[model samples]
Target: MAKSDTDIPAGARRRLLALAQERGASLAGLSELLGRNPSYLQQFIRKGSPRKLEEGDRRTLARFFGVDEGELAEAREKSYGATPPLGAGWVEVPRLDIGASAGPGALPAGEGAFDAFRFSRRWLAEHGLEGARLSAITVEGDSMEPLLNDGDEILVDCTERPFRDGIHVVRLGESLMVKRVASAGGGRLSLLSQNLAYPPVSVDVADVDIIGRVVWKGGRI
Candidate 1:
């Protein structure tokens, strides 16, 4: 039997369609990415065949899209009678009005919360990031292009930890920058950039201040 549009959650359908269009992804390509038949997503979105996405399929789509799984799930209309409040199974992470330079360096200016983004508590816990001090900052410059782009929002885990190899927000003198920090040996660290145009910089560990580790990043498609 064919399902009607009413049978499918409007929010999920619209969100998926918008993301697909923004990313320039065809329904057939997305279906193949999900390991499904070529017409799977087309049927779901156009014909409303499934009514709602399956749990596994939704999870995969959420990860691929760099969004919370709840975003892809059917919004609970009865819970709030509209959009749910941030307090409802969601954690408010502040978006700092500062840009962490991906190029040379950007001075840390206006370190205030200009806005906030809400994430599912369940999603945070699943990622082993529960109870971690999290904040968001914009990425600046093209040095980290192809990975972290200019204007991209990155979720930073501010929980202090011993230096390990990973992308992190570092402070050198008065400038704050985001780079892939790896041990250069002899008590020095190498700040690497994604773009080959920018060469890796080696500096003494004591000269750099680790602000936070970049856990996740999101950018416009």
Candidate 2:
């Protein structure tokens, strides 16, 4: 007989619940978003029916929540166990589970780091990023094509600073995105995209939440 959901570890369920609460999303809505019946997640969480989430479903949830797939229990147990210690002269930088949309928008979710990358201390100092809080996130759309491609991982400097003309991650309302930001004068700003197909949008500086500046990017060639 298959194990009941309640009989299995609850890490993934707890994490999902916390994310749902943080985003003010109902489980039924999230289930529908997953293309499942309204009671799918409700039953999975509350009634403990499906002992484990399907891999495809788990991947979708990971993308939607901006978290690593490993954070979702099964994968966590199979692969994302304890991380080894870092080598000398290397510093660990968290790779956030979030994705900064390069297209329309991606809802912000999970603020925790699901994985990390090691950087050379000297290289960090050379880039003037020493002691600066940094995070790595994946780009989710093709809006910033040529410069930033879909699935590209970017390093962001999270230190607070006055707005400057550069590629930065900004939160507009409930969505998080990465775009070329420039001053539009009169306390307004322009969110530009590299892809001409997508036109720019203008908004008040005060209305946007500047998460951080994109310092570097790496992706498949």
The lDDT leader among the candidates is 1
Report every candidate's CA lDDT: 0.81, 0.80
Candidate 2 residue-wise lDDT, 1-221, digit = tens: 65554564567776777788788989899898889999898777765567657656777888888988667764333321122336768877877777899999998565557779898988888999877777788999999999999999998887767768999998887688999999999999999999999999999987787778999999998
Q: Tell how far residue 141 is off in model 1, in angstroms.
A: 0.4
Looking at candidate 2, what is the lDDT of residue 165? 93
* Model 2 alpha-carbon miss at residue 97, Å: 0.9
| Global CA lDDT computed for model 2 | 0.80
lDDT of 1 at 15: 83
**Predicted structure 2, TM vs. truth:** 0.61
TM-score of each: 0.61, 0.61
Clashes of each: 0, 1
Cα lDDT over the full model 1:
0.81
